[model samples]
Target: MALRTLFADPMLRMLVAAVLLAALLPARGEARDTAQLVANAAVFLLFLLNGLRIARRDVLAGLANWRFLLPLILFVFGAMALLGLGLNALSEPLLPPAIALGFLYLGALPSTVQSATSYASLGGGNLALSVVSAALLNIVGVFVTVPVFLLLGGSGQGAVGSAVIAKILLLLVLPFVIGQALQTAAHSFTARYRHNIVWVDRMAIAIAVYVAFSGAVEQGIWTRVAPQAWAALLGLVAVMLLLAHGGAWLTGGMLGLPRADRVSFLFAGAQKSAAVGAPLATILFAPEAAGFIVVPLLLYHLIQLVVAAPLASRLAQHPAGDGDCTAPTTTATDRSAPPR
Candidate 1:
């Protein structure tokens, strides 16, 4: 049926498997401590492996297109800041100042591989561009995103400190650099072990989810967050997702971007990267707040998968003779297909 198989993506499947493992066979008492370590290692290795898969050339090329990417990055940043301000003003206080701040965090998050490619493939956006864009977003987020979080993640934690920055450098940037260096040194090994390593990414995320959730659970974090807060958080998540998707679609038409590029923008721009955000949040925020900060990210992850899959399918099934998003942005390249 050419339908998207949830199991086709070994990482997604592994994540599902890990979640089921946690839910169905949750660690208890003495087993809980060891389980936590495994989960944390899993999360670390995920990014380590994600870095290993990217082609250095594509990341470099995406950098070359700064004219396109820079503006988009700025636009996202500005929109997030503005939304935070506006949402902060609501007298209902449905949105605490922290939420507005959290929105900015989610807004500043890096892009993902699967969803971006899937949607770029849908609307005929640039595959190479999508690849590069996603990579650059992740790379930049490692440095700037966390520092910004420290500076602006609000008083829930004071200004993000230099030591905090150092941790990010250690955990994320340093390991990613080491991974890239290793990949360059052992291209053939990486290629050979790619399938085995794919599971690493999923296991990593599940480990992250468990560790983050567990830490919060241990501290009785949910009891602190009101039921109304959960409702508000869900509402805010919905509005932001709608805005991201709708805004991307509208901008594609208004900017007159080629259909393929629009697809790239829609998928790449709209979705938040949990793989990147989870590790960063755990390291930066208070253990109790990690759950709150990460709730949006996790929601964003699920939403992207649920929303984008069908959305891509519908876009792909465009009616005959309809004006296609097949137009090229630079050369005659077909952005919809995998780059030849």
Candidate 2:
């Protein structure tokens, strides 16, 4: 049943397909250039839709809950990022430098708005808070991830300079700002067709992955990375997952959060956003290096989904309440829709 649930995710299947397709027939020369351009456009559209969908009121609500939000931000970007640095140092001897650096990249990423909220809902968490917190984390991620990555010593083949900052502002931040500005006019349309629009997110991520992996393949990634290195990488990722989930849960308890909020924190603090990570990698790294840098994130995303399903099921069954572990009630106007 767990295996079925995992495979049933279309986004997951799309990502796997993207990786396999890149391996079998990676774009090169003119094709590579064309694919990169398409990926860029897709990323812009994706962020624009995010800005349209995330209500300003929700942002304010999340901000108002600073006690909950502050810790979460610190955990996702601070403690987790430091953990990534440790993992990178440990894995340096075992894996290639770029792939090892992926640990820090993964650590620095934001929580997944979709998966975190979905699983939080499934686990009988505070759905309203889950949606708002995860959305805000993504918003914060766009601004903070690059600086955090660089501060923690993450750099790709391409130098991060004025050009890169301009690209991020133009392709990512600017589009989101445009969406926010147009939100009053487009909110109804975005709300009405959100489920359909999830495809845009998935497709953008897939395209970015395909492009990054294509360059890696062109550079002979398979030959450069050894089988033993793959095993070491998986082992390291598992350790990081355990720490992420356990640490979040423990922190929530230490802070005396209600069970429902704890559930929300568990998922929100632990999961990383491939939606943000993949596209941002393309912007930050050269194509060949971006592929290796994203490898850890891709693997972590898959494993988290598999783990979250069963964990959520378990939590749902044992709603040992400091209060009922069901989603909090909120009106449509006040509630923020979780992004896919």
Candidate 3:
């Protein structure tokens, strides 16, 4: 039963399998180039599909929930960034500077679209607000994050940030817009086959993860950091997530938000975008250091999944009062499972 549950989530299994595959057969020589090409293509398709999956109704509804939306957005971009900078500063003497910088980058990223909204739905939250806020952040984050990184004195500063932004426009944003445009033409087909797209999304992300870990492996990523450093990174991420979630809950309470909106706020405000973060790290950071920088984001992504799944489940078990956005009649499923 334990093993069955462990393998229940296809995405989680794929993630673990990808890491192991990278460890055993890290890409080299010509294969590395091919892998890069595949990863890039996968990312483009992933975003495009994401675009197609989004609905205009969600955006309009999200606008209506501005009170909840605004605070969550501020938390994602502003508070998280500042908190990371401060933590990095305080821990500078103890941890590697790269790891510190990694935390900062992680904080600066936008909230995830699919995962945040999915978890929100699962937790009996305001799905419309969650989806809308998440979509808006990704769109804005493309422009905002790089400049913020520069302001924080991130390495490769202007030049690297510029390259990342350009790539974001061409690869990420454009495909998404194109997908959105094609949605109307493909509506019937997409509606029929929407469920299948989820696997494609999972596969694309898994491919990206494999290529990233392979690059890191080639750079001797495992050799560079000690076990103690790994533990420290984990602890720091846990604290940050806890603080972010607590703040979101408190902020929603102060604003007199409904239970559903508060649930949406917690997930949206606390979650970071691994989908964007992982690919962007490759372009922004040097090859040798990209893996280390990605460590925090990767770990945090997995940790959030583990932590959110149970909480969402628990939250769903409770009843919502008046004015609460009814959790979608269809349940949201966890795409990933924790390692056994």
Candidate number with greatest TM-score: 2
**Which residue pairs in candidate 3 collide?**
none
What are the root-mean-square deviations of the candidates from the true structure over C-alphas? 6.0, 5.6, 4.9
Q: Which structure is stronger by TM-score: 1 or 2?
A: 2
Alpha-carbon shift of residue 210 in model 1 (angstroms): 0.7
lDDT (tens digit, per residue) of candidate 3 on 228-277: 87788788888887776777666766667888878888788888887778
TM-score of each: 0.79, 0.93, 0.85
Predictions in order: lDDT: 0.62, 0.89, 0.74
In model 3, which range of ten residues has the least summed lDDT?
A: 327-336
Ranking by lDDT: 2, 3, 1
Which regions of candidate 3 deviate over 4 angstroms? Answer: 1-7, 156-161, 316-340
Model 1: per-residue lDDT, tens digit, 157-238? 4235777667666667777777787877768877898777765665677676665555555555456668887787777777
TM-score of 3: 0.85
Q: Model 1, residue 10: what's the lDDT?
A: 54
User: Looking at model 2, how many pairs of residues clash?
Assistant: 0
lDDT of 2 by residue, 1-340 (tens): 5556677888999999999999999999999999999999999999999999899999999999998999999999999999999999999999989999999999999999889999899888999999999999999999999999999888655569999999899889999999889999997899898888988889999999999999889989899999999999999999999889988888887777999899999999999999999999999999889999899999999898878876787777667655443432222222122223
